[model samples]
Target: MKGNETPRSTLWYFVVAHTFWKNVEVESFLSEYRFTIVIFPTMLKIYRGANGKYTLYDDGISLDYLQGDSVQTLIKWDDVAKKLSLEPASKQTATRTFQVELIPDGVTKRIQYSGRPVELKF
Candidate 1:
């Protein structure tokens, strides 16, 4: 405990996925036969902050790709904001004061475990 430290409500984490590329491939089986396929891929970006906490900010596809319409598997930013507490942390003041408490690894681990039960099978 520092003398001039202010404890924060909850640390924020962000995770985001964006459409990076779309491609079509053509293949020839024989001299007179041909096949074509279309492919779309998304790129995921994650930032690991203090104590190994992950950040995921969603624009659109991550929610659908993760939980879909009817399932409640993954937690969204809105849900996180509602369920957990939040405090603003700026780059300037972060250096001077301990504005946030280090959430125990076990708690985050449980959250990560419970949030996404099913893995995307390829």
Candidate 2:
């Protein structure tokens, strides 16, 4: 049910039943076991930046902690270039800026409701 889960097909279920119930009625026992699989939409995408930090998008936009955050989710990871955003923080300078943003809890607590970082999740 947690984020760190791998979806397994019927074959995997069968194999697992065999492993745990060797020399027993594994098939019928496993059939009795109910698996309520919940599927969540693929909301986030991560791209390894040239600078080495993993840039998180789509996922960050949904977090309550980020609701007041100024960091913009400019574009989908695939649609943009190999590098991230093409725009700068200011027109006068070429200071590189990432599209996504994260705010510290101290500031968020002073301003808004908080939720765990859904995007930065491993």
Candidate 3:
């Protein structure tokens, strides 16, 4: 309920990967009443599952921040891999998995969008 924290009702859960960039084994946590604060310079990746489930990956530069599904900030985004791109889902078919890393603008690097989960191999 704080100024920086988003509502817990909107978020179901979130996964975070901190410092362990080599073989990231992200941790998943159910959203709680308390606020999840993430420090600056952290990179966030939001993804949706194939069965229409939303997931948040908080790749912190130094800390973690869960429950940011309501984050609506304007920023540039680039596909993590050239082979993967974000596209609209067809009427009869769901979109494939893809990931787009947020490009930091020195202000905010978080964004809420529609994306599918890619393997956490990074």
Candidate 4:
């Protein structure tokens, strides 16, 4: 929740990642380069199992987004960097919510999204 540190919860990360990459496009060339095609964005969900393993759900994302279920084939975190990299040119009226959870020393902390990132305190 600070700097480059994301929430440890896979679910939270997944939601963030999904929202960040909600609108993505891919372009490819057809055989002989006669035609070009645009690919649609896919929906993806991520969660952590009780065993501490990460599980990804791709029911919403199109086939273009997945090479396999394994994390390696899934889009990397950097893929959505542009979305998360936005900087407010000026104070806007629009706002959104983001949630964060932290677990340390057997203690858990929950933080709610309050629009501006400056309001967030890890």
TM-score winner among the candidates? Answer: 4
3 or 4: which has the higher TM-score?
4
Model 1 C-alpha lDDT per residue in residues 10-100, reported as the tens digit of each score:
2232333321111222222222354333222222122223112222223232455244222222222222222222122211111011112
| RMSD to truth, every model | 21.0, 18.9, 14.3, 17.8
Q: Write the per-residue lDDT of candidate 3 for residues 1-122, one digit (tens) a residue.
A: 55544533222223322211111223333355653543222243433222122222332343323343222222222224312222222222222222334223222222223443223322
Q: Is candidate 1 or candidate 4 better by TM-score?
A: 4
**lDDT of all predictions:** 0.23, 0.24, 0.29, 0.28
Off by over 4 Å in 4: 1-93, 105-117
What lDDT does candidate 3 reach at residue 118?
27
After superposition, the stretches of candidate 3 with alpha carbons farther than 4 Å from their true spots are 1-7, 10-84, 92-122
lDDT of 1 at 100: 21
- Tens-place lDDT per residue, model 4, 1-122, is 34433332212233342322222344444454355554432322222221122222332346633554321111222222211111223233223222222222122222232223332222
The lDDT of model 1 is: 0.23
Estimate candidate 2's alpha-carbon lDDT, on a 0 to 1 scale: 0.24
Candidates by TM-score, descending order: 4, 3, 1, 2
- Judged by whole-model lDDT over C-alpha atoms, candidate 3 comes out at 0.29
- As for TM-score, the candidate ahead, 1 or 2, is 1
